[model samples]
Target: MSAKPSGSETEIVDGGSVRRDHTDRFDLRALYETSQLLSSSLELEFVLNNLLLTAMSKLLSTKGVALLFDPLGSAYRVAASKGIAALPTGTDIVLDGIDTNDPMLEDDVPERLLEHGVKLVFPVAFGHREIGLIGLGPKFTKQPFEERELEFMASLVNMSSAAVHNSLMVEELKLANRDLDGKVQQLNTLFDLSQEFNATVDRKRLVKLLTFALMGQMMVTKHVFMIRSVTGEGDNGSNMHIVTAKGVRKEDLDADTIASMCAQQDMVLFVEDGDSEACDHLREKGFRLVLPIRQKGDTGAVLCLGPKMTGQTYQPDEIEFLYALGNLAFVSLTNSYLVEEQIEKERLEEEMRLAREIQERLQPRELPVMQTIDAASLALPSRHVAGDYFDAVRLDDDRMLYAIADVTGKGVPASLLMS
Candidate 1:
């Protein structure tokens, strides 16, 4: 079937000319179907591809392309292409003076488009802004476009622009929702870790929980944990001591290396290509991130780990979460140490009280009476048991000896000696 020129009205002909109402009916029906198809989906790619295909088939063009405007940036890229093999999708091209006012012919189109073999350019526009462009090659008839054809094409593009803009907005909203979900999950993980840590007093158990939380949340592969002191012993003037480690070679991060890390007082990333020797050294030791576990503004511990198991770099937000967990670990451990010290002090005080009682019992309650001599004894007990002893002895009828001795040291040992 072909449609040819018939005065001011178009006609449909099979073997002979048809009336103008039939052709009008056909075009009206086609436009209705095209509107239905374009409004069917919110998927940007599907809508653009279908729109371009419909336009090319209607116009009898061999090639067509759709370029979408990037709402977040100042660039336009090819979104859909047909019957053109050399053009690359996502390639950006700039077209100046191509306003959203109306559809443009090849002469009115930008000169830059000639290189892409585009003959017709339609601005898919809505609300005074162009959201996309539809480019079409020459029609198969190789004839100039009629006024009615341009008007129809303009209507098609104008109607589809709103749908395209809505689809792009929907995609942007989905991406924002996904990003918000990730942040929420990260916060939940940190909160859970903090609760578990606050309940924990044992250093080993705390480290184990930290490792599990870190690996579960951040997908860590290799890590080591260090504290300022261990069992209050073997500090040997060093500030940091390694408590536990995994996947680390010996001589890589010793007490000296940890001291250097603590000196920074902030999180550090070891870059393999860094200009600093210290960072390069850390990188060579398989450490990608080092964090200080601070308590009361002092670095009480350190945490070091390699790259994520998935080989992704640690993001700033993830590192901040690690910092928070690290500080929580330090505070928990410090509280445990304080509680242990308090208990030890209380035990020592109780022992001193018992020792004082025993020493009092060992001393004479009253001095013996002497018929010919007057004698007095004074005993003073130290805050800790001092173990002082005194005795009045009668040797024969006329001889009396007074003896007194103070023992060395204090507490239970001195109290036992006095007894």
Candidate 2:
């Protein structure tokens, strides 16, 4: 069975008796309640506030109190307080060594507290670590804290330390969960956008769809689609050209400037107000980005997206999303252009095959056999039709003449002239 708490008393000098009062019983109950409440609370701020209030109400019975901690700084910072009229969020009290060993002792503590009439202090500890210090002002009942009150306060600190540790773990878990959820949502949106954008073959329509889709999904304020000629024959010095734009002036974009900015085969991003020397021209033109559209080793063009519609600075996650979007867009655009080129190539090949067949029919199948002269002639066509021609004519009295000549070029014109 647990030992019953005795209402012990002691005699002091000056004809005064130091008796354990009813307040001590109340203090024990308050300590138990504080432990129970803290055990259930997983919030760090609630645990701190509850600990401060409980100490003030039970341990010293102070009308006002403040809790300070070593922020590992030059002074003790107030972490929490109660019953104070005005307490700054960050208030420090300097320490002077009255007693070198016990800094929390009343005589060794700050003079500012002594001037303010503070009487008692409790040094909070967890294992070997001194977590903080709690200063209690003069008691509301005008009595000093006895030994029993100090014991109860120490027990409260021990129980509350476990709660503080658990609350910190819970807070960290909450932050990690939020970050994971954000990444998952971004990936899901990117996947859906990629599938939708790649389903079409029309280059112009694909770019427009991708631009509008990204603007709607990514919450961008503006979008610009640029295309570069692989053969590089245009008014712009570089092959980069803007195909479509929204929320920016057409004249503001310069292909040469964008190419120069993204010279080292990397994507460019600008989300904040200021601009570097590499991007100052864009800032002067009130543009935010000149993201490169690249595929393989080739720098095709750029897709410039402006600041987010929310008007807040772009976070790291947003920049990552833009990088991913640019990659996917580059692949899709390259695929569409490649498909178009293949179709054109196949069409030209078919035309060349038909022309070759027509030219073959026009050529002489068999040369006239020459009986007088003991000679034979034959012709063979190369993979592509060429301009070699040979013919034999019968002359008077069985005298035969044969001639062979080569034309200048190959293909239909050469084949026609040879015919």
Candidate 3:
């Protein structure tokens, strides 16, 4: 079967007659039916079943196995088998110390195969490439397989080799498509979550959404969100603190453990199956994931998750979704922080304006505005709002008293003191 000269096509050079490999076939119609049935379907199992049945009927064998080459593993595994209880199906075989890819029979077949009741070990090749092996036990009549029977088996295997290769390719294609669809659906989900996250600007409410998303999507219960202070926290500092948490008590979250992870994962960290000490420590604490939200060039916040309720390892796409979610959280939190800061700045500005006005009122605006001794006065502090006091008092008709004093400090406080 393996790129060897076909037995039926051989010519006898030593004798005047050419002997073709022949079997006691009823007619050409039976061979035609065998060919048509095996070629009818691209289903590997169906093809293997019909092929093995045809072999057993033609050769009267009681045990058989269809071994197909797995290209990825570079080994042969049993695809189908029957009546061979001693041989383990589904386990790959290396042919253990075999020399040739050519078909072997009788004493030439390896001893290990002999132990498994393999009377015939032939390769099924398509064009120039051998794709599989056919192993058969001794015939039920206890007779050894004849050369003619082996020749017929080879023809049947060759006819089905093309179908077998096609079926394997189709199965691999189906798996690849399924994986792609899963990733695309995951992306669509992340896109929708991003929209929701952007619309919410309140940090507390945004955190709640993030928490719910993780729990609902990942089926996680024990989790914490450690948000680094936007104004002060950084990879070099301990300003990161748990802003929201569930299941885990506050006391159990060690500060050093949290800070160490923050420093290590400056951009992002998915803690599943990592060998680093920080990752190991986190895993030991029952936390399986840590995602740090990037703000500027540092870690702005982090979300740590415990073991999933489903108890499954995180896939690549799920980890990617977490990265997307973290970025959305970063933007929302930063916007909320900026809005609060601006509001506080405006409030302080308003208070300063009011204090400055009070200081102006305390000054002698017109210096009595009277014709008593042609008196004149002016007062101006060296700063925007300062503590300074000066006044002139007219008594009766001819007496007058002028007073001046300086108060401590500046800005709003000093202006209030001057009054």
In terms of TM-score, how similar is model 3 to the real structure? 0.69
| Tens digits of lDDT, candidate 1, 1-419 | 88878655677777775656324422766777877787888888888898898888877788898988775676678989897666678778777767656677888877777677789999877786668789998888887766677777877787777778877778779988987898798788778888888887787787788778777767888887777764544233465656567787544675556655666544555455445655666677787888877667877787888889899888777887887877777677667777778889999998888877777676666767778977777777766677688777778778887778877876567767767
TM-score of each: 0.65, 0.64, 0.69
lDDT of each: 0.75, 0.66, 0.73
Please give the TM-score that candidate 2 achieves against the real structure: 0.64
lDDT of 2: 0.66
Q: What is the C-alpha lDDT profile of model 3 across 262-307, one tens digit per residue?
A: 7665344667667787887677677877877766777777777787
RMSD of 3: 7.4
Query: Candidate 3: what lDDT?
Result: 0.73
Candidate order by TM-score, decreasing, is 3, 1, 2
Error of 1 at 238 (Å): 3.1
